[model samples]
Target: MDDNRTDKVLLYKGVKTMIFAVLTLFMGPIILSMALSQPENKLYIPLLVVGLLICAFAVFLIFKGIRLIMNSMFKK
Candidate 1:
């Protein structure tokens, strides 16, 4: 990649990770609320599962971003 494209990608990646973190933080409480509101029929299970999946995906992306930054730093 060209130098400008590489720099842009790195900046965009940091922004993406921050956005992902914010989304996870915001969704977590809402999901937990939905899960807790209904108790008898085990309604929370599906919500919990989906929420965890999303959170895991976000975390994975964040880690990938960090690794990319580290690799670039070391390469430079």
Candidate 2:
């Protein structure tokens, strides 16, 4: 790969990783607050489950981005 293309790829992966990390951090508090605020509501369970899934997806995205960056750096 050319230097320009490699730099762009690295930048994209880094940015994507940061975005996923931010989403995970942001969603955690929102999910907790929602669960705590509506303890009596039966819907909270579903909401919590959905929130957990979203967080998990964000984490997966983060790992994927990291893997891409690492592969780019170390590939023979």
What overall lDDT goes with each candidate model?
0.70, 0.75
Worst 10 residues of 2 by lDDT: 1-10
Steric clash pairs (candidate 2): none
The alpha-carbon lDDT assigned to residue 3 of candidate 2 equals: 52
Write model 1 residue lDDT over 2-71, tens digit each, in one string. Answer: 4523455675676677677778867876786777778665767888787777777777777777766665
Model 2 lDDT tens row, 1-76: 5453355677577777867778787897688679868979998888888778777877777777777776666554
What is the alpha-carbon lDDT of model 2 when measured against the actual structure?
0.75
Off by over 4 Å in 2: 1-7
Badly placed stretches (over 4 Å) of model 1 are: 1-6
